[model samples]
Target: MAECTEESTMCDPRHALLLQSVQSGLPLVHRPYAELGQRIGMSETEVIGLLSEWVAAGIIKRIGVVVRHRSLGYDANAMVVWDVPDGRIGDVGRRMSAFDFVTLCYRRPRQGDAWPYNLFCMIHGKDRANVLAQIELLAASCDLTDVPRDVLFSRRCFKQRGARYAARALAAS
Candidate 1:
């Protein structure tokens, strides 16, 4: 197998082909791995085995699907950040996450004065009014009505995709 290093711009040819095949997005088939393998002259087992090896070796970090929420009519997207007391953050975050409207939630360190908020959650809805209403509901239900928070609505959609290892490797080749 070929080796890739920080100084080396390329990787194994087979791995390069496999990465290229998946970079665009996996096929919408019952057996996507098998389809990927067939496209690159590899067997389903070979594809799965290679992916496993790379993962164990720390060559691949993660594999996940990127959903296009706007295409699904979820036009209003807001990231609601809050400044909860350190002692209450865990409880508040948990309660906030329990809501079906909150698709994502996590915590971050409060930036001194530049940014005071810590806990954060994402809410997506069909319209801005609905999203704002949901935020109000979240604040009331989570006992966060007194918390200092901000609801930032996205004004633009960014291209969502996975890593581009194949592009770099191909450029080097």
Candidate 2:
């Protein structure tokens, strides 16, 4: 896999445009990208090509939606952090990611004395207690009894979307 860098050539004009469109997300319309392309002075085919190229060049990671789970009746969401041994981190992370209940899982950099967890997982449920129980079951199944973890429940959401690329156009101009 190509490593992410700030000065990568993949951050070209088309890539920038694709980033802007992705950050804005698909509009709630029958032809969202086509409409978006019209607004941005490009055809839908061109936009799709840009996205495909960006993905090929590893400039963009993944494109997907961020559903408003709470509004959709999913009231519970928790960030579960685990401190797995260095050798087992990959194994544990893969296992967690394979679980349907585990929506997101990755190894984040460990904070100093405050936080030592490296493996992080996000779980969603209908309620807080249900989510907690699910986490406990997951831990047990993974034979992670000795693993130290903490559950951070979200209380509020401010903004959730991809990055904007309008600034790139402005900079070019």
Candidate 3:
């Protein structure tokens, strides 16, 4: 990969346009990269090369889809927070993340008496009862039966989209 610098990422006009096109999400079609290149006056190879360079240089952290679970028939979305022991959080988190039902799992710092939970995981299901059952299974599998935790279910759906770095840059220009 070629050396990546601040100027390489930001000074290139083509890169700027490419970033803007990607911000809204890649086109839903075969050969999306090629399509994006055509739109930005680049070849498919050039588009891939720049994106790869950005990822390798840490300019781009991740390239992934933001799934709308509700549209996929997953209506019961719950975030389960656990007050795991500090020393065992790593192991516990790994175990929790291994379950297929658990869509997301990570750790956070506890606040105070009002909020003592640290570990967190998101579980999406077709219904509340299914989600609750999966949580129970998770507790048993991770040996977190005695752990203090809470399940906060979603009351409403929110719009989900990718970051708009290029859009903001264009607005500022």
Candidate 3 residue lDDT tens string, 1-173: 22234654565667778888887878999999999999979999998999999999998878896778998999899999999999999999998888888998989999999999999999989999989999999889888999999999998866666676666555555
* lDDT, candidate 1, at 97: 88
Count residue pairs with overlapping backbones in model 2: 0
- Sort by lDDT, best first: 3, 1, 2
Choose 1 or 2, whichever is better by lDDT.
Answer: 1
TM-score of 3: 0.75
Which consecutive 10 residues in model 1 have the weakest lDDT in total? 1-10
**Compared with the true structure, what per-residue lDDT tens digits does model 1 show for residues 48-158?**
998888789777667676778889999899999999999999998999989999999999999998899999999988999989999999999988899999999988866
Q: What is the TM-score of each predicted model, taking all chains together?
A: 0.68, 0.80, 0.75
Model 2 CA lDDT for position 33 = 75
TM-score of 2: 0.80
CA lDDT scores, all candidates in order? 0.86, 0.78, 0.86
